[model samples]
Target: MIAEPEPGTTAEPEPEPDPEPGTVRPGGRTARVRTAVLRVAGDVLAEQGFAQLDLADVARRAGVGKTTVYRRWGSVTGLVADLLGDMAEQSLPRTETGSVLGDLRANAALVCRTLADPRQGALFRAVIAAAACDARTAEALRRFYEVRVAEWAPCVEQGVARGELPVGTDAGEVVRAVSAPLYYALLTSGVAPDAAAGERAAAAAVAAARGGVFVG
Candidate 1:
């Protein structure tokens, strides 16, 4: 028999080979990785609250290596920032519905749908909670809203140019008006922002725009 290796001195066994390619689902490898991170991060935030989040845990649960996670997103805050950006880009673009009221309705409906999503709702709440104490989180949250508002502002500007809204309408405020109350309702009365609430918000926003409440 060959000489036995010294105790604890045998060449370390080579690591097992990684799982085969077919073992991986490729439908959205990138998206899957992103979803995993967000879900894990959101879970951590909800269960232990934001203060206790650990990037290592998130990476482990996401089935991604910590080195990969760190290489892509230097910190938890950075990951959260990218998550928000992904969400913003994935959201529907504002459409031209001819009338300010119609556009507002469509916008309000979209907001309601998004905020009512269990995942989105929880993620948003966690982000808001994080924003309360973290400046970076707060700035990220604000930037997310700004990007969203900018996506819809063109509708208000279009209305103004068509004489549907006052010439000097503040497109930003008009867009903000469409969803602000719905957000308030959801946050305050614990109400589900239903069709009626959305309609009301849209109508209010349209009325404000027509009445020049958004006039600069």
Candidate 2:
């Protein structure tokens, strides 16, 4: 877990500029190594939090050489960025329910389930905490949400096309609105949002959208 900085404790300075690492896609043994390292990294983040995630520790757990882990990922932040990228890539596609409300409900359900899951919930909390102190992790989190929002934004667009929503509705904002409350409940209360909460979130977002609240 992320602990707040003690009084007089200074934050870590940002690292020097370097090429973004861990964005490469390789096949064969390279792919296997990447998968194993990432799996171990995620396990560490979920179980022990970001403070305990060390490249050498991950290398040992993954049965890979420390040199390889260092060479490929370079730093903890790089590995985390790669891990988040992988998660976004592997996430389930948006469901098409033939209506904006239905689709947004589906999206809300997915978010609820993910945040409610034991490992996934812990993992998200850890990453979110890490993002608070680390610029790279924060950027990775932003990119992750961007990818997710883009995936579901089409539902709102479809709703507008079908005249179910107002013209000029911001699709991305609508998508973000659906999941905002669920995340807030999770972060603030340390409680996973239930299905009923998801239902309410979906309904509220739909109501707001229909009211032209998301229009711009």
Candidate 3:
């Protein structure tokens, strides 16, 4: 008879096989792994910026297999793209408050809150910086803002429909105007905007819209 294996001498378990890229379903092990990996990726981006992000480091930090990360994301730019996609997917829908000013104020408040959060602010700065040099990341960042701007454009359109604003007002431009100054402040001053600044942004956008500045 063969001798039994010695205690504490069991063979190491095999590493899990990499899942087919884009074939993993949601709300199971795959979802959990994605969530964990993205969270770690965001943390790294927030703390160390994009130049320092590495798939192997992210996998190790996330407690995921390096092969899995490599197979799924393929590169730093790919991972960053997925991270931006996830952020766009998870952003809150626009709030409706029955008036253009109220809705715009709500949008401004949300933008301010996001930028004011230390981790989130840093993450955005890092991503924006990365976008300046990486084409894939730049496209991803553009898509993220496109998603956000689209979500808020309805507010301006509704205001025009209600005759509160001039006809032919460019809804997308009006919506973008509200956040432009807030973002400018942050980027220029390295300071998160406060609530008062949000109010000013909303009011300024509304005033501009009312003045037909955004009319095409």
Candidate 4:
């Protein structure tokens, strides 16, 4: 038989579940909550930009309690940070195409496709806009790129190992180079880069890598 609690003493409540990403913990209910909340948050950001993001609104759309959102995320910046972290965790892994040029082409194609995606492109613009004036959001955006760059950097390193790329090439720089022009065009001209642009970006980066511009 289990012993009863002493008089005037209270039993401990169940522990809260963990968050999906970032600083939050993860568990059954917690994961579900995070999924719902982040979905709504992304929708809001994509639809109305960061200016329209509100914890109460997200909670309403997510069917979660406002208190829960506030208590868990603390602020809009916190939610965005966690959302970016989740995105990084969920992003596709790098491709290995045996050749540096082929691998970079694959990478560039992925970036172009993402930028061409209406919802994804809008979400990225919103996040980038928020980062312009928000230090926390800016930091989170940097971290997101860091995670993505690290994921693909190994492809460049493998190319160097195979003698396809120059020795001492900066793998991260090469990886970023493949995507930079695509992002720049999208942000500057509001143009969704096509497959041709992807190919061009990859070719340019490969040429630069061969020319040892990425060497460090």
User: 1-216, model 4: which lDDT tens digit per residue?
Assistant: 112246787542243664444665465567778798999999999999999999988987887767678888999999999999999999999999899899899999999889888889999999999999999999999999999999999999999999988999999999999999998989899888999999999999999999999998
Give candidate 3's whole-model lDDT: 0.91
Candidate 3 segments exceeding 4 Å error: 1-25
lDDT of 1 at 185: 80
What would the per-residue lDDT of candidate 1 be over residues 1-216, giving only the tens digit for each residue? 112235888433332344464475555554566677877886776566667777877887777656656766778888778777767767789977898788889999998987788767666767877888888888888888999999999988888888898898899898898889988887786655998889999998888778878786
Score residue 194 of candidate 3 by CA lDDT. Answer: 96
**C-alpha local distance difference test of each model:** 0.77, 0.91, 0.91, 0.89
Question: Please, what is the TM-score per model?
Answer: 0.80, 0.88, 0.89, 0.89
lDDT of 2 by residue, 46-75 (tens): 999999999988988887767677887999
Superposition TM-score, candidate 3 onto the true structure: 0.89
Candidate 2 global CA lDDT score: 0.91
- How much RMSD separates candidate 1 from the native structure? 8.0
The predicted structure with the larger lDDT, 1 or 4, is: 4
Give lDDT: candidate 4, residue 137: 100
Clash pairs (backbone) in predicted model 4:
18-25, 18-26, 19-24, 19-25, 19-26
Candidate 2: which pairs clash?
none
